[model samples]
Target: MQTTISLEIQRYRPEQESEPVYQSYEVPLRKDWVILDALNYIKDNLDGSLSYRWSCRMGVCGSCGMMANGTPVLTCATFLETYAPGPIRVEPLINFPVIRDLIIDMSEFITKLKQMKPWIVREEEQPLSDGEYLQTPDQLTEYKQYSMCINCMLCYAACPIVGLEPGFLGPAAIALAQRYNFDNRDQGKKQRTEILKEDNGIYECTFVGECSIVCPKSVDPAGAIQRYKVAAAAEWWKSLLLPWGNR
Candidate 1:
């Protein structure tokens, strides 16, 4: 069996370099080690200047997301043995500006997420004495899958639309908007629809389905966008047919 592996990690220091470059480091190959483990080895032993993001090595925190051999993945969850006996290429998530090595800027994603209003909005707040807004098992199930998103930004990297149309609201944001839209206790669906129906919103998604395929959490963002399109079309037809009725 091979005793070691090589990782070609992308490096970028704006003050030092005008463009990103790859720097390679060799580390021990162990069956128990994941991609993050190799990265940690590089950071600690090989080169302390090597930079990346990671937390909760258990895969709960989405910070360890990176391009592993050209695929977007959570490094903590991807085992090194899967790409054994050779070099692995690691790069920052695409479709966003790289702040530094292995760390992409998330400001755009954050702005779009805020537009989704990823919380339960109410037309009228119920009194505290009225008790918490309750939901049944079925109601909880409606948005459970989307709620699993850890904001890893893997979906954004997998989405071609995000690369082409920089203004397009990426997959995770739309899926989260649907999460709140489906919640029984939320009254923010109407508000979210206004944003989603816009040019750079849900309509921009061409339904390539790669976003869902790469999602580590199984949050089917592509399906969510399609569902929203269907609903939006239906609403449009209804409004056209019944001019006098309240939408």
Candidate 2:
């Protein structure tokens, strides 16, 4: 007997339907196939109208994030064999407006990321003749872990704070902010601190911790956010105590 598995996918079409619906397909269950391969089979051979977003088949691009069996995961890296002898539910990442089938509108996420300014900020540009900004290995390690976020938004999907408070700056945005803030070369820590200290920023996170659990890259955004909170609190105290000094 041939092995097969059922894929129940959530689909949304704004033009034809007001709300989302589920569609099912059965595909060959191969040991080596991942969830993405099953989706491709459905698109190519079964249903052409079914829509979703994916770029690099490898895990690097992070474009294939989706909810598999009620958990946000990278489809490219989640193998079908894990969910073996049965049906699997696949849907768009939660906590965002669905654009179509599996693509969530990330315009808000992009805007928040921009607000954090996840880049090195210098008060003045250094001349090229001065040579590159140098960092020791210990300094590099400070921010390298948080720099692995690929903007997949899986963290957003898993974060309860995002679901409860739509305006909150989500995990990836805050983590990326810290990524730059930790860099010895970055001079924008004060600016980023002001932004993150806002009402809808890090304070909004209740630390349910689902964000870190769902991250495919193991970025540990939850840890970064907590660390940032500590720094922000310390800065606030310093400002209060030494108003005469440049804190």
Candidate 3:
């Protein structure tokens, strides 16, 4: 059976126009084909001028994230059958400035990630003679879920907080921060609390639950942020209850 896939794609040509607009393309597609495949077909056969990003079609690389039918998803993982009743409206992820076509600029997210110190900091001055940092099964389970983030920025795309307040560190970075903060081998939670507890930190999250819903990886970023909030609040209470505890 021949299927016609209708795509209303967002477009911007810097040399020709000042603003971006939507352009339609109808292509014969296989029902089994993924949205990314149809996008590739359009780029190859219909419009060579179209621009987007994709790599490692297995969904691990996360380079192909776009608004598929108004939802933020990895194009490689989104099947045409998922939205088969009618036309699929494709656009760049919301709450971000469009660079061109399906591409949205992520410089702001990347820069914020660098400021949070997302990696583990070692306390020992000497090299590890133990070869590897040991972790209990429960300890691994604690942060293992948060560590699965692919940095796809889908949660950021789904985040209304980041859109409204640019200072908000957003989901992915906060999730990453939690990943390290929860790690058993890490001893930097005190230092790391500054970033996670600041104005744009966990407080910025209104518990909209959108971040957890749109997450493709099943990473509960909202939970991670909330866990940190509870911890920070308890620490605040501790400081008030016993001044010498923090001192």
The best candidate in terms of TM-score: 1
Model 2 lDDT per residue over 50-83, tens place: 8888999988898999999999999999999899
Give the candidate order by descending TM-score.
1, 2, 3
The total number of steric clashes, by the backbone 3 Å criterion, in model 3 comes to 0
Clashing residue pairs in candidate 1 (N, C-alpha, C atoms within 3 angstroms): none
CA lDDT of each prediction against the hidden true structure: 0.93, 0.93, 0.85
- 1-247 in candidate 1: lDDT tens per residue? 7999989999998899999999998899999999999999988888998888999998688999999999999999998889987799999999989999998899989999999999999999999999999999999999999999999999999999999999998899999999999999999999999889889998999899999999999999999999999999888898899978876
Task: Give the clashing pairs for model 3.
Answer: none
Residue 132, candidate 2: C-alpha displacement in angstroms: 0.7
Per-residue lDDT, model 3, residue 28, is 70
Candidate 2 has an lDDT of 0.93
Q: In model 1, where is the ten-residue run with the lowest total lDDT? A: 238-247
Clashes, model 2: 0
